[model samples]
Target: MTELNLELTKEIELLRLVTVGSVDDGKSTLIGRLLVDTKGAFEDQLLAVRKKKGETKIASAAEIDLAMLTDGLSAEREQGITIDVAYRYFATPKRKFIMADCPGHEQYTRNMVTGASTASAAIILIDARNGVMPQTKRHTHILSLLGMPHLIVAINKMDMVDHDQATFERIRQDITDYCAMQGIKDLICIPMSALNGDMVAVRGENMPWYDGPTLLETFESLPVLGQLDEQAFRFPVQLVNRPQTADLPDYRGFMGTIASGTVKVGDKVMVLPTGKSSTVKEIVMFDGNLDEAFAPQSVTITLTDEIDISRGDMLVRGDSMLEPQKEITANVCWIGDEPLEPRKKYWMKHTTNTLKAMVTDIDFKTDIHSLEHEQSDQLAMNEIGQIQLKLLKPIYADTYANNRATGSFILIDGFTNNTVGAGMII
Candidate 1:
């Protein structure tokens, strides 16, 4: 490729986003509309959707089951509700997007968390007629707690409310007030009818009084947060490469993705849980060697000194003051079918490290309805609470607020080996 083509490819940034809201709030329809309007959907896919039986139509246009575009499962279509998270990919001239259509039912909140966990921004749909419902508040609270950088409250189904300005303003105020209470920082409210395409990909004439960027415009313009190179260096060693071949007998390289920050040749680094210091000798890749590498990039590095590093060991800056701790308190969202009880053991997987851990105590459970803290001894399914954990071995970490890559973990049930909970270090 030419230099200009390479630069253009680098400039086309990818945005990871999630759609969340109460049941029947048009989450699926909005995504389908985006795909259709952006020309992201294939002709065969549109043809398949047209064959599905549904009374729903976008605005007053020809009959098209837009929700069927994302609701791929038979169960979801039969029940007329989303159950599992459905992912869709689309692109415009300015940007590319990977959107997750999350379930809205309260029982499937865990699925919503799974979708929102890695998203940079979220589009929360609120039915204009219902305003802010309980499920909407619950999803908002979860998003805020997860430290979502951007939130777009799409007031959907404006056509059903006669495109009334008063109704839009009232609902917008309610969402604004609630988000403030949750301590959300960046937020924007847009009045849109996903079914009619107003304020979505195009600004239909239905709500000309409300002037703002269309949903696609806002998505293309929102500042992308969490630049990994700006944070402290964190490289969790996933493997130690050693080829005993005669041509390259002494080759020893530490291989892993840069979880956060940057690393370059000759940079002094330290191995965690061992405190062995070394200097980077080479940054190796399949194409060739690089002078430096940053977060989210998987590469191999041969250090100047070999200090017996292995999997689960993390490499940091030589002068780093990060300490490994066996005990930690974290905010956890329980997702398992069984209730989480104190003194129960589970496997805790943080970054590339996994070890036995036990829940020591449940600090308090959060009431999603009122945003109140209530004392509790155990956490049930879809419940959020603060809890204490003791690990079998120490691991280097940072607070989730400071660095999500190294601070978040998942708990696996010992018997079933299923991921039962997700936690963020406090």
Candidate 2:
């Protein structure tokens, strides 16, 4: 195929991925090199970053630190830490990718949560010398808990180990055992030297014994659209678009991003909270009308009848959907500086619905490494536990394993507006 044809074909496949690991395990470097070697980085920009590759460069180490490419914040540059999720976009001949480079510190686990919320797959990096450490276990455990079905374990720094297949096998077995205990079954292990560009964007002769696909090759083989299509339909109204003026008078529409599934014109839909029924009259994107809309696509939807609908309302197919529930049980990861308090109400935002919720009971605390659950009264910062919650009003939700967008929620300090916890609805 011609270059233009190849580019056009690739536009049909889009992948959203996240890279995670312990501090200095080459998570960012792997992403940076992947983007750079794929010709995803601009020449002028890469040259500018390359100019500072020397001993005097205080921002990062000498030897062209690829991690610096994604570490954009001044605060991060000074401290040598990633405090928030940094996103980058790049496309290859076979696919378009949106990469989220998540933070590695235990304190910034919330950042990882934010990134993982949207990722379809995750690349968990581990240094060959370190093998499987506590933080590696923590990252992998969190990935499993968050229900990321596709996982790639890149055992980096193979060069430092003289590319020994025995060493690679040992580390791979360790990770396999760890993840197996956590109930994460789908895993791909690759021995790579991200610094040397070995088996990253291109196949290398150094690993002739390894017949598995390279990183880029693996991406090309994945069914990105299939996974995106597997989700059930969910549309949460962000804002009720209504213009009562003379121009486009009596235009009442529901504007929001489709959380999952597909919606089509003239489809029978049910409005939540009020339980009103209506048909989708039109699906409008900014440019024009659309026949259908799927997950991650933002569009305005007009209904045939003037049924009552408002912000925080949900539109769904009348059949095969869960009813709204006032009481919910969830696996909670406490991210706040203060511990979770019982009987104190916190603001919960699930999809588009915001309501007050109080913790009714604590079931158990989860140990990430051992996959053990111990009964606990409260969850402290960076702790994961199971809790029962009572919401002021019913919210339509799915089990986290079913649909991530509608099943997960965030807890905020009602008075301070600070996000305190991340929860997966069970």
Q: Tens digits of per-residue lDDT for model 1 on 203-239? A: 9999989888999999899866467688999999999
* CA lDDT scores, all candidates in order: 0.86, 0.82
Per-candidate total of colliding backbone pairs: 0, 1
Residue 220 CA displacement from its true place in model 1, Å: 1.3
As for candidate 1, its clashing pairs are: none
Model 2 quality (TM-score): 0.90
User: Per-residue lDDT of 288-354 in model 2, one digit per residue for the tens?
Assistant: 9999888778999999999988888889888846687999999998988888977878999998888
Name the Cα RMSD for model 1: 3.3
Candidate 2, poorest ten consecutive residues by summed lDDT:
54-63
Q: RMSD per prediction, one decimal?
A: 3.3, 3.3
